[model samples]
Target chain A: MSHMFRLLETGFNPAVFNMGLDEALLRSVAQGESHPTLRFYGWKPPAVSIGYFQGLHEEIDTDACAAQGVDIVRRITGGGAVFHHYEVTYSIVVPLAHPLARENILDSYRLFLGGIIKGLATLGIPSEFSPINDISTGGKKISGNAQTRKLGCILQHGTILLDVEVDQMFSLLKVPLEKARGKLIADIKSRVTSVKHCLPSAGSEPFESLFSTTVGALEKGFAKSLDLDLQRSEPTLKELEIAAELAAGKFASAAWTALR
Target chain B: MKLELIGKPEGCKLLRLTIEIDATAGLSAMALIQSISIRGDFFAIPEEEFDALERALAGVALGKLGLEFSKLARERGLQCAGISGEGLDEIVHRHLATLNERN
Candidate 1:
């Protein structure tokens, strides 16, 4: 008997909907309601998701989010605020006893980051996995990841930058104004690079094209590394229902928004 | 009365502290004073010296004794600064006032 892996490429869903789907998939996997899966998703409305331990009032400008119609949500995992835009996000859920699960947290991050590194290589972007789970190009961060484990399963998700509005991000975040001024802000800008920044001559690839290319590369890399075929599929009915429930009860709630 | 230092020794230019209210108020009634700036004109010091300084300062309570130690650091040419965090002073004072409630 061989393990089955499914690749769900749900492109450009609303932030709440995508978070709901990830939770739903994790639940189904834990309950044995669905097979272990890898899901690639994107945000349509463009939002900032803070880590579970992060304080919304401390990390985000709620007024700015509301005024811009950006959905503010908390992730199940732990990390700082991630501005999700012009990026490809991946979520992987696997049983706790799986080989990948036996590895230490950093080891597991490296394993998944390996696939991402390979994917970026295919796009002519030579990348390296930095300590503490960030992918960088020439010392500038291009991606960030976070993970959570529950009920015999682990869900890891990460973001790859294609293009980002650095100035807008600085404005919307709650970082100290002094930190965002002059040299400090310029230092941060220098340390964070986008794919568009890397490929100035190409005039930035279309989002759809970038999505397809990156997903195809990731699927191929994972298949090669795991020695398994990644069958493309959609969420089962039960998974969809569970995701809807999580979205309504948790991801879309004020309690969750205000949680630290 | 004693104080416990809790923070990384490096990357901490000024020590920010929080004094939580608890029943063991008198047992931990020390004001925390941090180095405003490390003096001696050395970029880094020996780990053993740093650790010794930390251990020596661990349980010193606030008062004349604490002020005397700060003066000594200045005389020894060590630069340091400190400030309390939000609600820390209020919490500490509240705990001290309620010491009678703790039997």
Candidate 2:
């Protein structure tokens, strides 16, 4: 059976709503209620999302988050903490029966990440897929991806850094003094570079423009690679309701956040 | 059995560990010993102690070490399971070897 691809771009939503949408899409696809979908979203007021296995108390300063009105969320996937600022986040949901979905986790990462690598390449940035799940330029990570498989559906989501505040990110996380003393922090700083830093000479492309270009490139890549016609559509009322329910029940709840 | 100290003042850490007891002790008994207390300053604690604790717990048969570690970390006021249960022993042993090499 031929698969249909739909791209839904929900620009700059609050953290709660964005997470809700991801869960909603995952459920919809899993239940055969919706076709395979790719979503591009951003966080308004900004936030930090930690992996499911992470500890918020240890990985994040709750006081700082509250003071800054930054929402703290936990994704269903596993990975390190990521500060969502000046970046474009993308999520792809596919039924497990899909040919691409049958691949192993790392293979799935490569499949989805191909779009991201191509996206960056189109913008004159030379990026390559690093082992596990990062897209980097000259050893500096510009994108990190994570995934969750449930109910025969696969959901992969990740961030593309447009500009990064390394200091702010460092301050928000807990780094042991000993590890901080060595080249660890320096190593991380050296290894992770943002698109803004890479394009310092571009003179004047706003973050939104860059994000749009990246998303456009990804859409084109998916269409060509999957051999499918793509459509951009708004979420159905049922999907929006499901997302809100998921946000209230899972993503935005203390029970989910406090689960270790 | 091995005992090690880690972390620094204010965040100092302590780990009371027992590991690789004879198989006669049974997996549960070895697990109980591996479940030894761990608490102290975050900085004063030696890396070896953490490695030892992870290895000892990971050695427990039947994969009960994950649940035990989870309970132990909570009691010790630590957040998150530092060690993963997937390939528990192998992963822990690999991590310990790495720490040993670094030290």
Candidate 3:
């Protein structure tokens, strides 16, 4: 049996709204007000999103972020801080009772990540699921994901790396071991990979061209891998309202961002 | 490609233990925890409970951290992911032990 899912290609938005929409989708799916959803989006002016349990002051350099016009927000999921740029981020929401949902955290991650693996295959990059929650190729991480169960739904979100700027990222973050900052940056450069690096033809194509092509491939890959019947659609008015409210109240507020 | 690194929890936001011990006392005196802060990207459900726990950890004896953390967490019914009480115990003790050596 194939499951039907709502597909949303919401273009670039601010950090707070991006997170608000994800939570909105989760709430709607949990309440049976909306179908299971797959939303794709990007961040405007870029942003650094810390994990639910992360200390904002520890993970992000607020002065740098503010000076550079970058947004700082916290995710509802648990994982490391991620710099949102040069990638197509996706979020999937499914009912907890769905057969696709697994009770064990690791087991659940394996099931959801298959769609990404298949998607990457379409891009001509062979990748492996690095346990807990990462997609790796050539022993370097190409994608990282985070997950949390809330309101009777499993919400998992991750990014497919399209490009990377290791030096820029390190500038905005607090290096735990200050003395090893140089070594850590070099290590990350070696360990992290992007779509532009994997595809030979991407060098010739403009960034937009590669972005759209990758999105197309992922659509097919997810459909084939999960046997999903994806229905293209727009965010519901109710969802938008909820997202707006959440953005202003929860995600955008100083209190939530500094919760840790 | 067979990669032997079995990923259980990849990219786990690290939660490091930072403690302030009474520097005047020697190791044999059982160094007390003057202050403690566990910061990182680990999740504790009902975030409020975890914040309270961090505050409560102040003045706790270093030796009792592991057992006490588990007890307090259990009592509060706080569920945690990406971190453990036992793990915090080892990190704090090891770090403090090094300081003891230097003293």
DockQ winner: 3
Best by TM-score: 3
Cand. 1 TM to true fold: 0.71
Q: lDDT at B40 for candidate 1?
A: 14
Between candidates 1 and 2, name the one with more favorable lDDT. Answer: 2
Off by over 4 Å in 3: A178-186, B1-13, B18-37, B43-61, B68-81
TM-score of each: 0.71, 0.74, 0.86
Q: DockQ of candidate 3? A: 0.27
> What is the C-alpha lDDT profile of model 3 across B1-103, one tens digit per residue?
1101111122333556666766466542256667766666666655568778877876677777767788888888675666676666655566556667888
DockQ of each: 0.04, 0.07, 0.27
Candidates by TM-score, descending order: 3, 2, 1
- Accuracy of chain B in candidate 2 (TM-score): 0.31
Measured over the true interface residues after superposition, the C-alpha RMSD of each candidate is 15.4, 11.7, 5.8
Between the candidate structures 2 and 3, which one is better when assessed by lDDT?
3
Candidate 2 recovers what fraction of true contacts? 0.00
Better of 2 and 3 by TM-score: 3
Error of 1 at B19 (Å): 6.5
Q: In candidate 2, what are the lDDT values of residues A1-260, reduced to their tens digit?
A: 44578889988887878889998898888888888998899998789887665556757888887877878888777666788978889999988788767446667878888877777777678888875667889867899887777677888899988888888877676655543443245555665777778887543788788778767877776666555567788777899999888888888899888654
